[model samples]
Target chain A: MIIGKVSGAMHSTINHTFYDERKTLVVDKLNPDGSLTGDYLIAIDTVGAGAGETVLVIDEGNSARQIVKEDNAPIRSIIIGIIDEVYVKI
Target chain B: MIIGKVSGAMHSTINHTFYDERKTLVVDKLNPDGSLTGDYLIAIDTVGAGAGETVLVIDEGNSARQIVKEDNAPIRSIIIGIIDEVYVKI
Candidate 1:
């Protein structure tokens, strides 16, 4: 799982059939300390996550396929839930 | 697929049963220009990859389980092949 923040959205004119009705977002991965690492990954959103919202992303193929309801979809990374808060023990 | 370089290897006595005879290596993901991002992930190696060798990593659960011959292994990263070379078009 990746703790990331939704940075932006993406759109494709010619793409796979599974992504026809899904919203793909550009998510910036956060470090363990909750700081942005400046690296990003594209993830299919399940929960209604908007820009700047922290989310939980499952970067596993089976999990993504199960949520998208397609076993053969060539996809990994799905926003499973929205993260409300994170606390790091010092 | 993730283009990464093997940084080092890891050993854990108490781990999952599926990892008993497998070799897990620390891989540093590379950017499109082949520069290391400094972040690392542990992956089970299929090919005999050594430290400092560039490799291709499949970070999908289904693919990892397929290579390990287990349908339910809790794995997502696998070093599928040792990369020979990479070229980026300008």
Candidate 2:
């Protein structure tokens, strides 16, 4: 799991069948203390995460497919939860 | 899926059951033109890939596990094929 921020959304006319009714989000990777790393990935949004919201992203394909209930979907990254707070134990 | 080159190998004493007889490799990411991206990842190697060999990697956990014949392996990145050549049609 990774803590990331939703930067934007994406749209495509001819998308994979799995993404038919799902929203795609552009997520910028964040460090533990919430600093941008300049790395981003396209993820299918399961949680209703809006732009500027911190989210919990699962990059594992198996877990992601299981979450979406798709047996053989060409999908990987997925936003599983919207984060309210992040605690860094120091 | 990604194109990468094996940079090094890893050894762990206390290993996961699924990785008992598997070899872990450190791979550096490559662009379409074979340029180093300064990003790397750890992957379990299925093919007999040596260091400096460009390989095809499947980052999908389910597909990787299926290749290794493990139904519930906690793995994602896997080296599936060694690249002979990459023709970039640009």
Candidate 3:
């Protein structure tokens, strides 16, 4: 899983059918030291993570679909967990 | 989902509980134009993707588990499909 910060929310009126009950969020990838990696992705929110909160993102499609129990969701990323702390061994 | 090329294979005798029947592969993320982005990841193979094959990767955990029919698998990435062609409208 990749560490990311919820940066913003995305609203789309017309999207795939599986995204009906999901909220999308824009996430910026973060390094282990909590610094930005300058990369971003739009991910579905499963844990009600808010903007600026650190989240664990599942960046695969099938696993993302399984989180919502949709076998054929056209989604690739999802926020699975809200992280409180991260310990990196030096 | 992300497009990637299977660069190599991974073998771990001692791994997580869910990885017993899985084959791990090393994949390099690729851009739309078939160029390397220099990003690499280790992914479980659901399909029979081999070295040098372009494949579609699911980077999520729940979906990865769903593909293998394991709910509590400690895996986050999996190869889902093999790509045939990519069309980019410039």
Candidate 4:
């Protein structure tokens, strides 16, 4: 899993069946030290994470499909948890 | 899913329940144009992908768990398919 910040929401008129009730968000990847990596990804939100909130992203496909209980979902990324804090020990 | 090249294998003495009999590999992320992206990841190989082979990676957690048919696996990344070719349009 990786830490990311929700940047914005994605708007799509047509999508796969698994995404019918899911909300897609634009997320900016964060380094372990909480700095931005300048990389962005569109991920489905399952934990009700909002913009600017830190979230835990699962970037695997089968695991993402397991979250929604779907066997075949076209999605590869999904937000699974909302972050409260992150501490790094040097 | 993202495309990557298998760099090497990973060996661990201790792991989770779902990792039994599974092979771990080191994969280098690749750009869409088939260039190296300089990002490396440790992934569980589900297919028969070996070193120096191009493969498709499922980087989500739930989806990865679904692939193995395990409801609770500590793994986050997994190899799903071996790539035969990649075509990009300018």
lDDT of 4 by residue, B1-90 (tens): 899988765433232324446676667789988898967556778888887889999776677768877775646888999999898893
Per-candidate TM-score, chain A: 0.92, 0.93, 0.93, 0.92
For each candidate, the alpha-carbon lDDT, in order, equals: 0.74, 0.74, 0.74, 0.73
**Candidate 3 regions with alpha-carbon error over 4 angstroms:** B1-74, B77-90
TM-score of chain B of each: 0.93, 0.93, 0.93, 0.91
Q: What lDDT tens digits, residue by residue, belong to model 3 across residues B1-90?
A: 999988765443332334456666667789999998867666778889988899999876677768888774556888999999999995
lDDT of 2 by residue, B1-90 (tens): 456889999888897888778899999987545678799989988668889988766577776666677788898887766766554321
Error of 2 at B87 (Å): 31
lDDT of 4 by residue, A1-90 (tens): 566899999777687766777799999987545688889889988777889987767677765676667777787787766665544321
Write down the lDDT that model 3 would get: 0.74
Candidate 3 lDDT by residue in tens digits, A48-84: 7889988767676766666677677798887766666
Q: Candidate 2: where is the Cα deviation over 4 Å? A: B1-90
Model 4 regions more than 4 Å off? B1-74, B77-90
Model 2's CAPRI class is: incorrect
TM-scores, all models, native as reference: 0.53, 0.53, 0.55, 0.54
Go through the candidates in order and give each one's DockQ.
0.06, 0.06, 0.09, 0.08
